[model samples]
Target: MTTGLLNKSTSLDMKHLTVFIYLLLSFSTPLALASEKKNILVFFIDDLRPELGCYGQDYINSPNIDALASDGVLFNRAYCQQAICAPSRASMMAGQHPDTLGIYDLTSPLRRTIPDSMTMPRYFFENGYETLSFGKVYHHHTDDREYWTDLPDVPGELYANPRSLESIALLKTQAKTRGVKGVALGRAARGPAFEAADVEDDAYRDCAVANQAINALQRSKDKLFFMCVGFAKPHLPFSAPQRYWDLYRREQFIVPERKLPQGAPLLAFTSWGELRLYQGIPQEGPLSDEQTQELMHGYAACVSFADAQVGKVMAELDRLGLRDNTIVVLWGDHGYKLGEYGLWCKHTNLELDTRVPLILSAPGFAKGERTEALVEMVDVFPTLVKLTGGDIPESCEGTSLEPVLKDPGEATRPYALSQYPRGTKMGYSLRTDGWRYTEWVNIENKKIIARELYDHRDSQESSRNLVELPEYADLVSTLSKQLDTHQRTAARKVKAGQ
Candidate 1:
């Protein structure tokens, strides 16, 4: 009888132990997941269009970015909220539309408009990650200093090369001699339109940015980090090392066709005042063929130079064995005109100006896949949050692209929107599967000033506007309704703080 009683007691003890083990695993699983949180690295390039090899440009030598696309999802159709720098950066970082941010110009501070908005880096920092910014991530003073653990070190001069610095100083002296005031004074101070110096990559600001990123990666192995390395190449004043310039022949460069869209309103085009601000460019007129070709060559050389810098930072990530646990995103602020439509900069609501290059690589996702889903810059914030196992805040106006990341065939949104302001008018453009529709509205009175419609199935160059044609009236009506619906929905979400 004593033996039987002992056996019963032992069985009961074994059952209790089994229950305890089960409870322990249930609690420990979450802790393990939390400890393995993935790190994030963002490469933000300035004025880069989808002209890389990965984006089907065989002429451009963008091997680094092409390899990255091979190991990740390359988005074929990704657009920014606006074509300009400051407003586009603010909108994407805040995960809100430009209308909500109230930043249409380069001078407006993001915090002045939305003081309480949680920026992408700020959200990550608040969630126990160390956030670091190396270059032009938030447009200078617009960056909220409190969110970053490390901010960029301001350089003594605008250009890293001594020659370029001297050129700028000379320009300033000339401007003072001429007594140019206000906006013209600032424009006069700009250095050469393009520069090719026989110096190392460190002679430019972008190379320094890459070096800083490499060092940060080496030190942040023990903790999760959100690092943003912004490269300022391929933008205006296309200054790059002579080695990059040697990669291409100026004679081989071809200037894009400068044909204006047929039947399109004059309001759709600009005088390209941005390009005229440079020293070598004509103050007011079309550039000569030789000048256009030179500019194109300079732009291409700068792109390849930026690509090399990207390669350096990526190599460091792999060497440190952080490739598996780190998510790397390479994106451009917006596209450049590149002499298209007689324009030089990104101030219009055209495809060449609005469509940006976006690539994302992460652990456990499919490799060498490309998606043609219509996505916007705003979607990046929520997508990162979802990947990092963070809560998607209600204030985020973008939809999470998690589904598209998992399956390339999936469609997240039906359309993508982009807008740009010209004087007192705002051009709101929409891109759908088959067509692009744009409506220019008077900001003060909300009256429609002009309309443009381009059929992508017919031509990608947007050679002609079909909105005025009588046969396409029904099609225009349908697209206009869709645009209105999207705008209303976005406004509502912004007001509701969604």
Candidate 2:
């Protein structure tokens, strides 16, 4: 045997071989450890308002999220920065505002501005995350599925119809019901049938969504996984299984403490999306008390159903022993309008449409606290990167929430900005610590339509319009200039950082 190969049957020390193997593993283990980076689970839901237990709107039941908030920091004034799904989510993922990217409507794809740029998932993927999502993460129909590493289900199909093809009769029945009169129900079924008979939760989308989510958790790839579970509910059609509806007794549910008369905001016309019509169940002016209660009941039920699925995913994270090391973020894309501001749907500049529920829970996250400082959805991208020890993109406009997430009150953002394209009009809203300012610019007229200012310390619901008050005219002008300057420069400045 050659000198180097002369160890055949030689008396090598067992302890020495063991130590050598251990030494070899020490180097290899970190490479294996690369596979063990922190997992990121973003629990996203659709068209949900921040009026739940965590936001201190005790009108709804949200025990799971409430518990999560109790253990994590909750942002009292978290804004989505955009109202509609496509623009808002695009703004969030790219950490830029819609106007910055020029993704104003559903027709424009985000790739135009951020061509070859890293989005939220892509950024995580660049940082070694095995990114994926179930249900709706981006826009409902236009999201890019290629971003996910492994897509177990088509987002469009997860709830395009709740159940798989099993019973043709029941499926058709639900479809016809939703189709004929179900704008509030969300999308109608896309499947033909299902073999299984309808069970209480079987027909509900979140129930099936939860099942698939749990399975995904159990079979996650070794690399750090980012599972974005998008829950589409309480957005419309206002349908859930009867059980969730039963939870809210008709008698127990309460309507708005007070209703605004049609003429209260003398000049504010509700933009015709005006709450005066279709606030909830009724097709007419703000839902009658009974109908309002019914709509809220459906909404709460859908939220609860989604929450159960969230809990299942959380439990599985723990089951897989990924709890403390993993970062979990649950947020609604944008807030919903439940008969507030004479509006029902979320295409407005009011707080009802701009505010969303944001909860972050993980091992090192500050717990059970609130932040009055401004935070926007765009901040989500930077925060995730910071938390995972990844690079924050120079293009990201948001300030890293690391400072605030670590210390609730110590967080400092002078303002949070939200914007949207209204019907042939554009609106920008700015929310600071003590004042909320909004200005609407008609696209056709190219001039400011309506300007508003609310002193948050005195009026939280914004029931009174401070724009016309002579004493507050200076506040209105100051806020108006700030909003204009921000719109003209924020996006460009963010891009400049890159």
Candidate 3:
């Protein structure tokens, strides 16, 4: 009887030991995987439209960015929440719309409106990732400095060339002499719209950005990193190295059509105030054909210059053996208008201003895939969270694009929404798979002051507003209802603490 009892005790002890060992292995495996979490590289560009070779614009010399598109997924119809720089970038970084953040202009910081808001980088930093920012990730001084693990590097001056710098100094002196009203009216002496300086890549700010990013990658090999490198070219006063400018011939550039939309409301057009602020541009009239061509050439050259910097950073990732494990996302803050419909900058709700360039490259995803699904810039946050195994904050209003990333044919969102403010009235635009609808609403009473609709099937030009057409009234009503539904949904999400 004593021997049988002893044998039973031994058997029970062995079973308990086996269970303990299994549990240990299970927990340990997950820890190992977490320790090896993929690093993130967010390459952000300013004022970039989807005009690269990969996006079917072969005229632009964007080989590096094109190669990135080939290596990942390119979103052809991704739209920003707003066309302006500050509002659009704020929406993207916060994973919420401009309305939700209550930022409609270039002046207010997002935190000032939503003080408790957790930005995407803040969330990642909380998840034990080393976050680094270089250049203009946020709109200059509007950056949430505490979110980054370190102070962001200053996004140096506009031009590095001595001649360009001299021209800017002269313009500033002229502006001072003319006073604030004169400057506002563009009475200041204008500088050249474009400059092709015979300098090295580092002579510009973007190359320095690339170098810093590469160094960060090299040093952070043992830890997971979220590095955001923002390139500041292709904006206004398009300036680049002479090498990039030489890549394109002035004659090869074509001036865009300057005709105002036939039946569009006057509110849909801007005074082109931003362009007028630049030197050498006429303060009140349309640019001459020669001037337009020169400006276009400069813009394309800057794009190429930005692309080359992107290539350098990408090459460094591969050189450090971090390519396979790093997830790279290339995004433009907003699109620019290069003489499109008599507009020269991004301020309208038109497709040329709202549409941007978005590319994502992740491990285990198919390469060289392009998706035409309508997506918004706000979706970037949730997608990165899902990719990095991090928890997305409850305040993120954007949807994750993991499903689309896995299978490019998958349809996620039905439409994208963008808004711009015109004094007391607000223009809310909705871009669906087939149509674009906009309603200008009076802010004080929420009354729709004007209505504009464009039929994509009939024409992609967006040069005609079809709201008053008798045959399209029903279509307009349907789309207006759809837009209302989207707005209501977004409002509800914001109310629900999203």
Candidate 4:
């Protein structure tokens, strides 16, 4: 019988042999076993929103990401804990909410804030997996360097156009004439807000990130590796190759109607200082129609450009024959507002800012499914831990999403939560089955100062605030109580060191 089995195995092709090995390693074997551990590939996109073709947006050219969604479970209502890059990434990495991490701004050092916290990379490393990160895993490149097996390389220039650099130099020279010097001059000398350069995809920084990630995949194919490849396009300045830009017509882009939400507090809107830092954007006012169209066009082009990079790395993963036993997760750090409600960036507690794109594909799970289940970014850590057959930590505030991965229709939680800070006030927003309720409270006293209630069943965007209306009063009261209870429970868990 042994001789006959060996003779039959000799006739198997390479693909069949690989599948046999994968199935042998996968079936009835836990990921805790060192010899049979699966690989992890994570794509962390900077400032990416759910404007892809898979998310039902017809205009965006995202064939690669859409293909990923077809093979994975796409979370329709996934959200980040905070909209900003630093807090959202840190919260997801630490498997906690922004409130637990105590990190809200880009300047706050992660190690100093939570020195003993078990980060995702560190936890995986301790579980006998080789971990690697490339390009903008954290907002700062140097952050949590001690956790990874290898240090990530620093990314290249933001813009590759010679004219863009010349424009910055001109601005700097002009600033010198006005007596601005040193760091201030550099701050004042920004390039164009958007550029469509006639160059290859590799001319931009994200392509290099993709190339390095492909190389890493080639080198680490035989090992149990957890690798993160982050892309920095569609984030700022909106620079991309002309080929991607030529994929769309400028006239197809619609400028969002510039209007403030009715009854919203002054703090509910952002100044969009991030946009104003560019060369042509005005200091204060609605952007002109032409400028808005160009910015939107550039953003769409960058999305397609980033999608191409994703395709490269994913293709490499397949070529290396690692797809069957590997777990793949693609997510945006946070969503971005292209011009919704006249907002340009993600600093508010609005749905456009907090709702992110989350896709996960793993072995022995449902494929090509879209789930409306509400999941938070903080849940990623615990879910991965559970998928690896490890016990979740008691201190994790997020629930494991393993059940949802198995069955796309499973509901993991009642609602999704997000927060944003402005001056001395903190806004806590909750998204339930049909409504979004937000309350801005004084940070010191925790006294509610402003409230916003949007009925998602009626409008996609928050057209008007209905917190003070007589009809929705009872609903607002119920949601507010739920929010209070949720916060209190989280606080109690932290206090007890759970």
Give me the candidate number with maximum TM-score.
Answer: 1
lDDT of 4 by residue, 1-498 (tens): 999888777766666989988998787365446544678999999889998999999899999999999998999999999999999998998888888878999888677667888888888888778899988888877777877886667567778899899999999889999999887887799888888889988888899999989998998898889998889888998999999999999999999988878998988779899899999999998888898889999999999999999999999999999998789999999999888788898888888888999999988788999999999998998988888778887657888989998989999999999999998999999999889899999999999999999878655587789999999989999999999999998787667653
Angstrom error at residue 246, model 2: 2.2
lDDT of 3: 0.86
Model 3: per-residue lDDT, tens digit, 276-358? 87777787989999999999999999999999999999999989888889999999988888888878888988887888999
> Could you tell me which residue pairs clash in candidate 4?
none
lDDT of each: 0.88, 0.70, 0.86, 0.88
lDDT over C-alpha atoms for residue 89 of model 3: 85
Better by TM-score, candidate 3 or 2: 3
Prediction 4 global C-alpha lDDT: 0.88
Clash number for each model: 0, 19, 3, 0
Q: Would you list the clashing residue pairs of candidate 1?
A: none
Model 2 segments more than 4 A misplaced: 1-36, 140-142, 154-198, 257-284, 444-446, 458-460, 491-498
Which regions of candidate 3 deviate over 4 angstroms? 1-24, 178-190, 458-460, 495-498
Model 1 alpha-carbon drift over 4 Å, by segment: 1-13, 156-163, 181-184, 494-498
Residue 82 in candidate 3 has what lDDT? Answer: 94
What is residue 106's positional error in candidate 2, in angstroms?
A: 3.0
**TM-score for each candidate, following the candidate numbering:** 0.95, 0.80, 0.93, 0.92
Writing each residue's lDDT as its tens digit, candidate 1 over 1-498 gives: 999999999999999999999999999999999866899999999999989999888989899999999999999999999998899999999998898888999998888877898889889989989999987788764387898888868432245568777877898888889888888788788887888888888877888888988888888977799998888889878888888989899998777788898999888778888888877788887888899999999999999999999999999999999899999899999998878777788888888888899999988887899998999999999999999988998778788888888999999898899999889998999998878899999989989999999888644577899999999999899989998898888778767753
